[model samples]
Target chain A: AQSVTQPDIHITVSEGASLELRCNYSYGATPYLFWYVQSPGQGLQLLLKYFSGDTLVQGIKGFEAEFKRSQSSFNLRKPSVHWSDAAEYFCAVHLTGATNKLIFGTGTLLAVQP
Target chain B: DVKVTQSSRYLVKRTGEKVFLECVQDMDHENMFWYRQDPGLGLRLIYFSYDVKMKEKGDIPEGYSVSREKKERFSLILESASTNQTSMYLCASSQDSSYNSPLHFGNGTRLTVT
Candidate 1:
């Protein structure tokens, strides 16, 4: 079965501190990994995506994620945390084929402490 | 930028009532999806359409149906709304279901069943 896992249900980081959110996936083929952020009462926004090419992919709002095939992990990281960065982060894998679907993790809620 | 627009922000419907959620995408995307998002359950796929008039069931398709008569419009219908069906419904579109395509989501509809 194909699935995505976000180990951390919630994380708290101080302002200006670095942040890392773990994401792992179980897939059969080459996975297209993605990180998305959802603010309170707002829709989801793409943070970053890794299709192919370089393992490190950059996304909007000063976010970056590294895709590791060996470990089946695509971890999202940021150098500094901001108050505005607090939101629900989701890790997703795009399943290839005619039905192209996204398998999502339970999600990690990030709280930035000022 | 790709724009996926959902018709409602907040909706309140009574139990056993039929509900319709409309979505439109300005980007001529070939793939459109409907998902229900909850607090701990993350996002569950309800239905997806790869092309005009083509529909496929997703992870959770029970009590839900979809319509894609045109290339840019997709609608999700709930045969009979239930309290458990109250959730944040999101609509998304992608250029294709391929690895290169990342989904663009709408503002989401928060539906409440009474």
Candidate 2:
């Protein structure tokens, strides 16, 4: 079975400041990792995905994440976060095979201050 | 862009009532999934359908059943509404069976059972 853990329950960041959200996973093989963002009263949107090739993957809305095999982590980062970036972020993992079910972590709520 | 649509944005049901949640996707994707989101628990998969009339149980499928009579529509049914089952219901769809494919989600339905 695959599982993901997001340590931080909530994080606050000032606008135009760098932001980082940590995520860790436990899987036997290389996992398909994804970052999703959900605004208040809205559905989740895919921010980015990491499969195999690149360790550093860029995503929409000026977000990026690094897939670290040694740490079993895929942490999301943004150089300068905007006020609109305040949302709940989730890290998900999928097995490296035909199964498409995704196991998600306890989301981290991000609050941006101007 | 893929568009997944859930029928309701909010619903209030009484205990022991039969609840129905409907979802539809415009991308004609082969896979559709139903998930429930709670405060400390991210998104727990209730059920998923790989194809029309082919439904599979997910991690929390004990109280939920699903119907996928057509390719683009999937319906989740709750036999008896419970207070504990009150949560945000999310619907998602993926392009294919590939593990790397990302999911497109609907705006979610917040259900309250009283």
Candidate 3:
């Protein structure tokens, strides 16, 4: 069984400030990790994913996440957040051979201040 | 671009009503999934279909059923709607069950049970 944990439930950041959303996962083998963003009244959009590659992966909207095996984390980061970045973000993990069953974290609500 | 469409954006139903949530994928993906998103619980997989007419239970499948009669269509059914089951339902599709493929999601259907 695989599971994901997001330490922060809510985070507030001012516009032009750097932001980071923490995510950790527990899986037996090399896991497929993904970040998704959901704005108000909308479905989730894929931010980025890490299968097997460079630890630092870039995604849409100038977001990036680093897969740290030693820390068991894949935290999403942005150099500077915009007011439109206010949304709920989720981190998910999937085992190698599973039928695309993703184990998702509780999610972190990001509030960007103007 | 891959597009997954959910039939309803908002639904109101009474208890004991049978609710059908429809999903369709424009891409010729072989795997489709249904999930429910609740506050404090990011997303829980309700069911997934790997191929036409083949459905598999996900992490949270109790009180929910699904139908995959065709390759492009997948339906999530609530046998008896309950208040606790009221949540935002999301539909997703991926190219295949392979680990490398990412998922595309629909806008979601917010169901309210009263």
Candidate 4:
């Protein structure tokens, strides 16, 4: 079975500091990876996605993720964390078969500290 | 911009009561999905519909049913509302089953079954 794992349950980072959220996935074929962020009482928004071309993909709100096939990892990173960046981050893998199903990880909650 | 609208922002129900959660997408998307978001579970898919009057079970479909009578409307039904069914339900839509089309989610409905 395909699965996604986000090791960190909660992380606290000082405002303006660099942030990195780890994500790992288990799948047989070339995985279609995606990162999504959910704010308080709001729906999830797509941060970035990794298809085929580039190893490093840029996304909305000054976020980027690098897909490392060997590591089975797609880690999300931001140069400087803002107070508004505090949210729950989820990593998902698209299952390419008869359906468009996605396997999601246990999200990591980020708390931005001033 | 695609807009996925959930009919309710919050709901409370009694056990064994039948419950209905509504979702509507303005983009006329072909794929609509229902997922439950928990504290550490991230999001677990409950049901999905690829087209009108078509529905499929997802990872966690127990105690849940779906109806997609129209292109823009998808409804999730809880046959017997239980305390364990209290969760944040999210509705999402995508253009197709392609890798390029990402899901657009609604501001979830927080359902609490007493």
Candidate 5:
């Protein structure tokens, strides 16, 4: 079984400041990691995904995440966050070659201050 | 861009009522899924369909059922609407299986059971 854990329940950052959200996972084999963002009263949108090859993956909205195998972590980061970037971010893990079910973390709510 | 459409943005139902939530995907995706989002719980999968008429139980499938008569359409059914089922229901679809492909989600339906 695969599971995900997000230590931070909520985080507040100033607009144009650097942002980082931590995520950790526990899976048996190589994992497919993904970051998704959901705005208020909206569905989730894919931010980025990591399968193999590059450890550092760039996503839309100037968001990026790095997959650390040793740390079992895939953390999302943004150099400069905008006010519109305030949303709930989720970290999920999928087992390669298994059922397409994704185990998601508790999520981290980001609040941007102007 | 992939477009996943959900039938309703909000719904209110009484306890013991039969509730139906419909979802459709324009990308002809083979996989469709239903998930509920709560405050602490990010997204809990209720049911998933890999193909037409092929439904699989997800982590929380106790009071929920699903139907997939066509490749691009999936429906989630609440046999008996309860207050606990009141949450944001998200519908998602992927080209192949969700495990390997990034999922596209609908705006979501907020169901309020009283």
Candidate 6:
């Protein structure tokens, strides 16, 4: 079965520091990877996605993710963390089949400290 | 911009009662999905519809049913609500099943079954 794993359950980073969130996936085929962020009491917003193009994908709010095929990982990175960046981040893999569903990882919650 | 709207922000229901959760998408998307968000379980798909009057079971569809009578609306039904069903239900839509198409999510409905 295909699965996604986010090892870090919670992380606290000082404001203005760099941030990196780890994500790993297991799938048979070339995976379509995505990263989404959810704020408290709000819906999730797309952060970035990795398709068939370059290994590095850029997303909204100054976020980027690198898809490493050998490692089967897609890690999200931001140069500088802002206070507003405190949220839950989820990594997902799109499965192509009869249903074409997405499998998500247990999210990583980021708490930015001032 | 695509907009996915969930009918309720919060709901409380009694056990064994039938429950209905409504979702509407303004973009006339070809795919609509229902998922439950829980602590430590990022998001688990309940049901998804690819077209009008068509539905498919997802990863976790044991206690849920879905209806997609129209192109813009999809409804999730819980035949017998239970305390275990208390969760944050999210509705999402996508233009198509393309590998790159991103999902647009609605502000979730927090359902609490007592």
lDDT string for model 5 (B12-56, tens) is: 999999999999999988889999999899899999998899999
Write model 3 residue lDDT over B9-109, tens digit each, in one string: 99999999999999999999999999999999889999999999999999899999999989999999999999999999999999998877888999999
| CAPRI-style quality class for the chain A–B interface of candidate 6 | medium
TM-scores, each model vs. reference: 0.96, 0.98, 0.98, 0.99, 0.97, 0.98
DockQ of 6: 0.78
Per-residue lDDT tens digits for candidate 4, residues B28-59, read 89999999999989899999999999999998
Candidate 1 stretches with Cα past 4 Å from truth are none
Docking class of 5: medium
Tens-place lDDT digits, model 1, residues B66-106: 99999999999999999999999999999987777778899
What's the lDDT of the predicted structure labeled candidate 2? 0.94
Worst 10 residues of 5 chain B by lDDT: B94-103
Looking at model 3 chain B, which ten-residue stretch has the lowest summed lDDT?
A: B96-105
Per-residue lDDT for A18 in model 5? Answer: 100
iRMS values in order, in angstroms?
1.3, 1.2, 0.9, 1.0, 1.5, 1.2
Q: Is the docking of candidate 4 incorrect, acceptable, medium or high quality?
A: high
Clashing pairs in 1: none
TM-score of chain A of each: 0.97, 0.96, 0.97, 0.98, 0.97, 0.97
By TM-score, how accurate is candidate 4?
A: 0.99
**Candidate topping DockQ:** 3
Q: How close is candidate 5 to the true structure, as a TM-score?
A: 0.97
Residue B47 displacement (Å), model 5: 0.5
lDDT value, residue A3 of candidate 6? 97
Q: For model 2, state the Cα shift of residue B97 in Å.
A: 1.0
Pick the winner on DockQ between candidates 1 and 2: 2
